[model samples]
Target: MVLYAPLLFLLVLVGVQFALWALAQLGVQYAANHALQTTRVSGGTAAAGRADAAAVLDQVAGQVVVDPRVSVTRNPDTATVAVAGRVPAVVPFLRLQVTTEVSAPTERFRALTLSLTSPSPAGEGDPR
Candidate 1:
């Protein structure tokens, strides 16, 4: 039984660390997706999207993530959000990280116009 105690403790430590990492990853992914959606709005800006992502990461991830960073990119028609950070190491002197990105199309309104023109008044063969 004495020999098994250390192994059991190690297993529990690894399990708890993995669980925390998984939760942090999920939270970061969710934040990225949320930021992408926010940036997809007609008038949203990349800075705004980045702020939103950062806010969510801080709120949900807490200490699970270390050195977290948020990035946002925008094009004429699309927006993307990326979240990156290291998950606190389970083993001494080891570090593991996760990065996730989410993208969405921007929303906008467009105008439609229609015009009708009389067929060429004088077709070459038309009898006047």
Candidate 2:
């Protein structure tokens, strides 16, 4: 029984470490998904799309316990949006960074230039 105690403790410790790593990955995925959603709603406009993506990233950063650093890039011509973010590990005495990227299709419109429309008030309703 005495010999088994140390082994059990070690297994528990390793399991906790793995859980932290999984959490970090989940955080990265969350940030990526948020950014992609923002880009889709913002449309193909350069400035507005970037701003929307940034806002989404900010929201995720606020909720995540890890370091918050997000980058958003949009190609209006190609109608593609890319979002990237890094999540820090939660375990003590360990330094791990998990980066994730997500790409989304841009909005479709007949006109080359997107029309400037006022954004609806936050939490009012669905933007779509």
Question: Highest TM-score: which candidate?
Answer: 1
Model 1 clashing residue pairs (backbone): none
**Tens-place lDDT digits, model 2, residues 1-128:** 99999888877877776775566566556656655665565444545545664565565444343555556666663334444444343344666566666776666567588769887798877956
For residues 59-122, could you state the per-residue lDDT of candidate 1 as single tens digits? 8888888999998999988888889999998867667787898888889889986668556656
Locate the minimum summed-lDDT window of 10 residues in model 1: 117-126
Stretches of model 2 off by over 4 angstroms after superposition: 42-64, 77-93, 111-128
For all predictions, the C-alpha RMSD in Å is 6.6, 12.2
**Residue 47 alpha-carbon offset, candidate 1, angstroms:** 0.3
Candidate 2 global CA lDDT score: 0.58
In every candidate, how many clashes are there?
0, 0
